[model samples]
Target chain A: MLRQLEDRYVHGLINKSVQGFLISNHGNDAWVEIARMANLPPQGFESMLTYPDSMTDKVLDGACTYVGCTRASLMEDIGMFLVTHPDLEAVRRLMRFGGPTFEDFVLSLDEVHDRACLAVPELTLPKISLNDTGVGQYVITTQWQVVGAISLVSGVLRAMADDYGALVVLDVGPHLHSDGRIMETLSVFIAEPEFAAGRSFSLAERLA
Target chain B: MTSTVSLGFDALDGLMPMHILIDKLGVIMHAGPTAVRLRPEHDLLGMRLFDVLTCVRPACDGGFEDFRQVIGQPLKLQFRAAPHTRLRGLLHPLDDGQLLLNLSLGYSVVEAVSDYALTSRDFSHCDPTVEMLFLIEAKSAALSESKKLNARLDEAREAAQTQAETDALTGLHNRRAMDQRLCDMTQSRRRTEFGLMHLDLDFFKQVNDTHGHAAGDHVLLKVASILREETRANDLVARVGGDEFVLIFPDCTDVTLLDTIAARIIARLEEPIPFGSKQCRISASIGTTISSLYSEPDPDRMLSDADTALYQSKNAGRARHTLFKDAFEADDMVAH
Candidate 1:
């Protein structure tokens, strides 16, 4: 879909109008958060979490909205992703490779709503309900008013925390009055995840 | 007792029972354990579960059918049951005979937290999401310090790169760096080459002499900014010296496109930039050079050649572009 959009808009003139086109490159922040969460620093983090420098400048970068909220995960969440994603191949790959990868986790907003039913088990939801969006070179989204299985998500995060040492949660925030449901919630978790940015920047504070 | 299959550990069954729900009475679901003689429990089987166990959110009259699944997919229903009850719901059409529709009340369990909700770094063998911001202040601090250190590293790397090549006042690449790039180009074995150009600000000295060094700095910075805006991402540009700049067209984007780029730049500069109360008009004279990747020409020689071409551009008229090797004879000496 992103490819489709790119193809349609190659002139890139009108679109080039917006600013901040690059990824946040949040790895250093990610490394610090990992160290802080794991109680390690510099070379100390290498044993348990990862070497501080393991998170590089380019790797730290993301095609994201806010740079701060992205990074690192707990072990259990990694396991859950390995179990839950629709693509068994990806799950196997992640299990073999070790990841709380954004592509493996972040979904189209409509997909989030559809997946919510898996978590909640009883919510009737629409398929392909939300539009997938583009950022940098990727597409991610979140939706509102879908019944969520928090416990399942929590379980995934737990497994990830055990397997790795961090947990990650992503949010596009909320959309009010979407099919009459105020769609807002913290939807992602990687077991016990370290914060991406050392100093957390509250989206609420900025918006308010 | 009805023949039942053993479903692993009893402890898991306690928290998350695997029982089928039957619509006998208003009972939504039944217990996992069986009764004596393989018979279903008489007293509990048909009883409404709400009467036996309390619903935390009785008002939570939300439909379970439309829940979100996994990270972002619409959910599918899974049969859920409690350990203590024994009821099942079977929905069937005559053709299919019978379909078991097991239903269980969904709920949240409260585990006695060992520690206060803290930061993720502060959590150990604990649920990652539950540890709120509070009580993890110490870990947060350590995390912040480490983050600061990493940021410092990035800043240092950027600073080093800038120091090696940047023209300080204008924040543009220096002449030395541009020449290095060209030298690499001349030495390369690739057949395709870049178009090189030299630009000199017409009447730049007048701005410095009249408006002060601060004004001069502003104009230079503005020019650099314009060049950045007008050029493609592949292009390389530098402020080689006072009022003189270099532009490298890495790959030839057709001459028409290059002319458009040049024209757009001039048009942008033609707009009077606010220089204090008085607006300053700026324009540039340009010289162009195109060579191949296999061309083993000297970089310094190329710049000199470009400089010679720029002089003709200035001599013929400022705010215009002239090509070297094409516009001027190679033997024509450029005035020092």
Candidate 2:
């Protein structure tokens, strides 16, 4: 389970047959790989674009892609994800000339990362994740998945300069399938931010 | 035999199996086959990757196509995120024993910068770099070819979208488009006395049975074209349904003015479409209604009233226009 200020990222549990998961991290991008063996469907595949970061009310419509899976095993399937590399100058062009492309989105991602790193060099990680399966909309590409206990970087870090406070909650089990698709099953989004204004973060603690 | 976090497979070297490190949420951060040593180069440590990217909306399970577009080289997958340190993994069979995964340690970097921007002569962080320059050049070429295919697809989608709003045979605006047009007409009273003419071609289906669908189509298109040409410039012609057309004239004065226009249309359409041995006789029964500024109501009611009048015209005799207000008493009798 993972939790932050207001945003929460969750993934289904790893199945029993699956031994463990894989983890990867780049610059700030986190890519976690869950390895398992559940006779996956031989023919399975799917993919989509998720606007996890929607601070700008920007949406990529046709840019949203869908792929079908043909052959797969229960544990794994062929999946793909779209990390649009937009052109920033193109966005400025839209703001200036009147039209934009995926380049604008690509550039926007870059801007957000740069801004995060500039504000708090500790948090902003930008890497595309892949699911390699036909299920979940998110293709958990380039994640940093650690199965057992993980030692956190020992540092008294300050609150990152984020317009929206983020948080996450997840449950991992043996009855789960992983192939990068955006998850929309059982989750929660507090609310849309009024522009980039900061919202107070609150959560209920569970006591054993 | 090899050891792993999940499914175990054969070792690259007899001693060590490879490991690929990924984040806690399962995105590949780095991928490569590594030698298995009791003590590895990197160590796995972390609760989960909490970067805002993974905490995105919808939780990207996997629907998007992803590949690192390096400045140069084909878009081949360069890395998988299993674990960055002490890359350790296994090749084990799934519980179903149908498949086996050769795994590795996928590690992470505190932060990564994958996007760059470049400008001419010099480059900015946002501009395409030399590597991206090559990638974009090639990407353009590939996209150009893709555009060709997409164009055909675009046309097909457009055709499908168009078909939903059109008559199958005559290529005229179907009832759906007519409904939209009526809504639009309701918005403005810019033109006084908007007149709706609901017409049903006499014995159109008989023609279809006698001459086949082809001849009926020819006849329908001919009538529709003539109706469009004969009507006032502001009037609209639409195939509201099968063998039924509604001509809407925003300003035609009175029933007499409309009658003259309908008469001219009847005269123009008197000619038969020669289908095989026999000449198919063509005629339309018309029902008209007016939405006057002095007494206004819902546009749908006007169409309903006009449709009733059209039925009366067909009932009395084909090839004529009838006004609903003129026969409202009879309409009341039928309503009861």
Candidate 3:
């Protein structure tokens, strides 16, 4: 992502999420091996710092080699982890605020980047543009500095469809452009709005 | 140009689920759907409006005339029942000679919602209350995440700093840390005094040549333990080189105490350190200087003086201690 920006730096929050996904799912030994493979310090990435974009790429590449998975699958897992992890329930709750139904959430994709900016001013999410072709169909285009974001968006959309009890099929298209800013396309098809009962949500949480 | 649009009771109830309507005689004619749920134990119709709600604001009496005085103005009311839920609204005089009061939970919306087990369906669609709730939840969650991030960042920073200032091989303060401490003590505004020592191993190279680097590491570790054991907790000990160390005792200007400590360290080092089947033997020569010897102690001068005294110990013989002042006096005698 930093290749397109003047600073050429990726925020540590993104790197930390990758680190967290590796450690929690693959264990600390795996994370240690991957960090060592990437020539990172023993303490691994800190969540509040920034690193070179090349370093982020190196870590992701190292993770792919160590975990024995493709880059697209790994990015997708990280996306699902952010939305569905027990420790990150706050993230799921915030997403639920997109609207009452899954279709509302899809239509509100364009505003997701701005809403995220309002929450954390430093965060740089991909700018999403949704093209509604027909009923329950959308051509979602995401523009960002990094290429893997489209795969991640597909993962999030899949999880959110389940969250809203909407059965949907998602197909991730390849990168449309590779220069300047990377852009990718996704096709979404909602099969059933009420496929199953979803988890309940309340406006007022019973905070302990 | 003004027109009046009449709404049916059901339509009014659907629009404002918490409204209250009273006749000219201050009798409760109708209560909105949600208002009826506030006090489900008692029926609302035919009861005096003032009997169920206490007008806590505007100093209104329990009469239609008093209510009319505050018409078109904001009203603050509380349920006369137990748990006295507070409500904020405005009182308006209807054209049919009655009073209409539409109410909503104000700042206490969260607690009121929980207290009543209210859901989104209970409020009108146009109400901003649900949006307010969403914002509150989202901001709190973001605040928590930011705090966790901050905490982890702080931990990482401290760990990095500790690693930077620590010697990886000996687990002792490195030269950088020692230099910082010395600079701090000398540059302090207070009349701070301390005793500094320069100690070098007598035959560490021989041990490495005789055995191997592993044996040499074992001996160094033993020497570090001896130094730590002989010094006080507040004292600073650093490995400035492969076989050279620096020790600083803050607020300690007694040359005799420092000499005793130096002798103890050398004696402990002389004890043979066992490595595999071979016992590695080593000793230490130390030079001491007290900060009180200089008018304004400078780290560079103090270090040089200690080094000069250490060389004196080396010249006199190995495995001994020398004071900078004593070395100077001996030089004076040699000149004579």
Candidate 4:
């Protein structure tokens, strides 16, 4: 995982969750305490682009313990946080330009991840593929995962759909593959008919 | 008889037996009644054995077959019984191609009680492993803290030693440090040839009386800088007294080199140093002594000889260098 991503999540927690909680909530030392709980050296999380995935996982676990939240909930909150965080404004803009409608953006998650890989070359992002099962129903499969934060992807999709004003219903599952790959599949049903129709309309408009 | 045995087994279930039964295909065949009661969130029946428990010892390699190979042997395994609870246990095999995992709490009882909010009655009172873990952790933390403090103390001590040896105003070696250096060099087994030059500022008292002590300090600092600039890299310049300095040149035997250095220092000190508004003029009278010419070269004797030569230069004409050997030859002529 990228330290830039870790830094964003830590800053988000300090500003949002850890605010008014610590007695001496002054500087980065509070975050350093969280890192210490995770069995990392003090001041270990420097401004590097990539770090060991295991260390990041421990740090996230430590953050959850500090905030009195479960791992699943913390991942969801971090995903939601990244959407609106000013430091990640470029990422939000990139997600917006993925497609015109919410369905297009959801379907083009793999492309967005591919672009993300350009920024952090060592990132082992999940491969996302969308298969249209039926009318307004799409099966999104995320495979070849490294870090166990698939819940964060679900939270990000939820926030993205809300941003585009598209109503979406999601059914999430950890469908294990025969090759030992844990594929997180999300069956999304776009409730808004206009948003479903706008996917093709926006694509046509772009083609014109 | 069968009913009586079943009733006895059901009674024993209240004691919380820490064991699990898994099939060769890595599926949980059955869980002990105690294990079930402790880990309610985990549905042990039909769940993947590797998903519920991790093999820590004997090297399971995360493969079902690898884990199956170590079923008969005693092995350590970790079970994800609960979110906060850490379960470690030994694995044994049953006769019917099933594995039995005997479990226990993995962390210190003190930590477990605080973190999981459990009472002391919940744990076995005689388990020394918990106490040992706490002791080891405390010892490790103390060792690391001490190591950090020692590192900081070492840095402070080094800085203090440097400050003690350095002159505050001119940033040159002080008299005490120079004496130590001379002592060390004289006592060395393979003592190389060396030269010492004693320099005293001429008309320095007049400048201090007329221009004030601040101007005199400025002139001394300027003279220190000139002596340092004229000397070689291997040479040492020390402020030994007020308006008095000494230069020690190691591995130097040539008299001409010493003459050149002395002349350069005297010439450089002749230039007027700028005080606040007016300029303070000063000159230096230097005396030279070589260690190679003396039998049993001694630092104290060399210093005394250099001082005598400096007095002769001061008495003759100021702003000149007098060799100790020349003074000795003049004394010999008088005795003849």
The best candidate in terms of lDDT: 3
Q: In order, what lDDT does every prediction score? A: 0.45, 0.41, 0.84, 0.66
Choose the strongest candidate by TM-score: 3
Model 3 Cα displacement at B237 (Å)? 1.1
Q: Give the backbone clash total of model 2.
A: 187
Question: Candidate 3, which segments miss by more than 4 Å at Cα?
Answer: A1-85, A98-114, A121-197, A206-208, B1-3, B9-16, B25-28, B33-87, B183-193, B205-217, B274-280, B291-301, B328-336
lDDT score of model 4? 0.66
TM-score of chain A of 1: 0.23
- Model 3 lDDT tens row, B1-336: 889999999999999998889898888888887787676635578888888888889877677677778888888988887768989978888888888989989987888887786766678877878667766776665566678878887998999999999988888899999989988898857647999999999999999999999999999999888889899999999999999999999999888888888998999899999999999999988888999999889998999999989999999998999999998898889999
Query: What is candidate 4's lDDT per residue for B1-336, written digit by digit as tens?
Result: 434222233433334354666786778766665466455536788888778777777767577878767755756666555454556666665556666666676653344444444422233334444334333443443345456657777988999988898888898999888898788778759676789889998989999999998888888778877887888777889998888899899999688988887888788788878898888888989888999878788889999999988887888898999888987886688799
DockQ of the two-chain complex in candidate 3? 0.32
Model 2 Cα lDDT, one tens digit per residue, A1-208: 2323212221111110011111111111111111112122211111111113221111111011111211111112101000111211211211211102122222232233333233223332323222323222122222212111000000000011121322222222221223432221111122221324432221111011
lDDT of 2 by residue, B76-194 (tens): 12122332222222322233322122332222111111111111222222323322333333344334535665777798899998899877767667888777777776665643467
Query: What clash pairs does model 3 have?
Result: none
In every candidate, how many clashes are there?
A: 77, 187, 0, 0
Q: Local error of candidate 4 at B46, Å? A: 10
How far in Å is the alpha carbon of B290 misplaced in model 4?
Answer: 2.7
Residue range with the least summed lDDT across 10 consecutive positions in model 2 chain B = B109-118
State the lDDT at B180 in candidate 3. Answer: 91
lDDT of 1 at B203: 74
TM-score of chain A of 3: 0.91
